[model samples]
Target: MVSSFRHHRRGFFSTLLLLLAVAGCATFVSNISVDVIRHPSNPSSSLPAFHEAPAFRNGDECSSSSATGRVDIVMTLDANYLRGTMAAILSILQHTSCPKSVTFHFLAARPEPEVLANICTAFPYLDF
Candidate 1:
């Protein structure tokens, strides 16, 4: 129908606008430090296996925390799906101008130490 086509067109434009905005921010990335990682991948405890990904540095245009606010991402956590989340986080940080300014919050229905510990093994920065 014509109405369905109109809705799809609007959705396409909205997505295109968002992608352009993100790309614009990416262009402002001035310094990229690849040597050091934010959180060390090695977890002390015997946790599930996970490899560490490289960290992303903030662009010069990014404001200091004393001035700018942070972005928090919330996601539900579990064992199975947790294995595949590193790439998604990496992609978000890679596309953003302020990588360190972003924090991830994982909500678990019934929190478990092993699951939490496993997350630590993967992304040791926060209490996931």
Candidate 2:
């Protein structure tokens, strides 16, 4: 019984030491510093390029009944930021009593299918 207990204790302690060593190595590797390149204008540069949202001509079908009309503004902003902005606009629209118009323009240098789809999903009224 004593020998068995001693053997089990040695095994348990060896396993524990191995685990601690692995943990320490992992910590050391994770703590190693990495340099990241950052530009002074990175924040502004990350923003998608801007262009004016085109105006739609009023047609016979476009009577003022539309709750809100959307125009694709040209920009490189991602869906996450776009969603946040839309949420804010939506909140304001919900709180306001007066007839308010909420519009989103995708101001981008180039057309982005994913971004457009994202915007459309967020705002059903988005007009491409």
Q: What is the C-alpha RMSD of each candidate to the true structure, in Å?
A: 15.7, 12.9
Instruction: For residues 25-49, write the lDDT of model 1, one tens digit per residue.
Output: 7765532332222333445633346
Q: Identify the candidate with maximal lDDT.
A: 1
The worst-scoring run of ten residues by lDDT in candidate 2 lies at: 33-42
Cα lDDT of candidate 2 equals: 0.50
Model 1 TM: 0.53
Residue-by-residue lDDT tens digits, candidate 2, 43-118: 5443232222223245444436555453333344554475455555455445434312334444665666665654
Q: TM-score each candidate.
A: 0.53, 0.31
Pairs that collide, model 1: none
- The regions of model 1 sitting more than 4 angstroms off are 1-48, 126-128
